[model samples]
Target: MTEPLRWFTSSHSNNGGQCVEVADAQDHILVRDSKDPHGPALAFPASAFAAFIDGIKTGELR
Candidate 1:
């Protein structure tokens, strides 16, 4: 059985009303719209998400 997702928002959420919530689901990272929690979600591998975050910190992602 899988555990329930515990979604959280980043501290940089004051940049207007647009934001996303993220949750860790074992092997993947789940992302959902903060405006519509019950809406569709996008999933990415944990490693991939980590890489994306790293790229963001390094200003490598545009």
Candidate 2:
């Protein structure tokens, strides 16, 4: 059986209207708008999401 998604926003988030929520969904990372919890989400493979975060940290995503 699949585990339930435990969604959360970033701690650095200031409750602004542009925030997004993220969750771990087994092999993928699920992302959705905070304003629409029941709305559609975009999923990325775990490795891909990790690489994306690394890129951001290194300013490669800018």
Candidate 3:
């Protein structure tokens, strides 16, 4: 049997109707548009995903 996908969203996501959802499992991280839950999802390495989050927190991605 196939494992079900577990999804998560940013804690900072507001009720303003704009947000992104993420899913982390195994060695990869999955990102997708919250507005289109059944649409495409992008997969990234756990380390790369962590770095991206760190960059966002450090104001290097803004």
Candidate 4:
């Protein structure tokens, strides 16, 4: 059965610009632009999402 995604914004978001919303689904994490809630979302595997977060902490994303 499919479940509805509960989306949330980052705590750091201050409504300045270029924000994003995230939601955890059954298997993967969902990412979407805050500017367009009805727009497309990018799904990343759990491990990949962890790695992406690690990259940001280590400055590898830059």
Clashes of each: 0, 0, 0, 0
Candidate numbers, best TM-score first, in rank order: 2, 1, 3, 4
Model 1 lDDT, residue 48, Cα: 99
Stretches of candidate 4 exceeding 4 Å from the true structure: 16-18
Tell how far residue 4 is off in model 3, in angstroms: 1.4
What C-alpha lDDT, on a 0 to 100 scale, does residue 36 get in candidate 1?
Answer: 91
Error of 1 at 54 (Å): 0.3
lDDT of predicted model 1: 0.91
Model 2: residues >4 Å from true position, as ranges?
Answer: none
TM-score for each model: 0.85, 0.88, 0.83, 0.82
What is the C-alpha lDDT profile of model 1 across 7-60, one tens digit per residue? 988987785647999999889999999889889999999999999999999999
Residues forming the 10-long window of minimal summed lDDT in candidate 3: 9-18
Q: Which should have the higher TM-score, number 1 or number 2?
A: 2
Candidate 3 — which residues are off by over 4 angstroms?
none
Model 2 C-alpha lDDT per residue in residues 1-62, reported as the tens digit of each score: 77789999888899675798899988999999999989999999999999999999999999
**On a 0 to 1 TM-score scale, where does candidate 3 land against the true structure?**
0.83
lDDT of 2 at 57: 94
lDDT-based ranking: 2, 1, 4, 3
In lDDT terms, which candidate is top? Answer: 2
lDDT of 3 at 39: 96
Instruction: Give the worst 10-residue stretch by lDDT in candidate 4.
Output: 9-18
Clashes of 2: 0
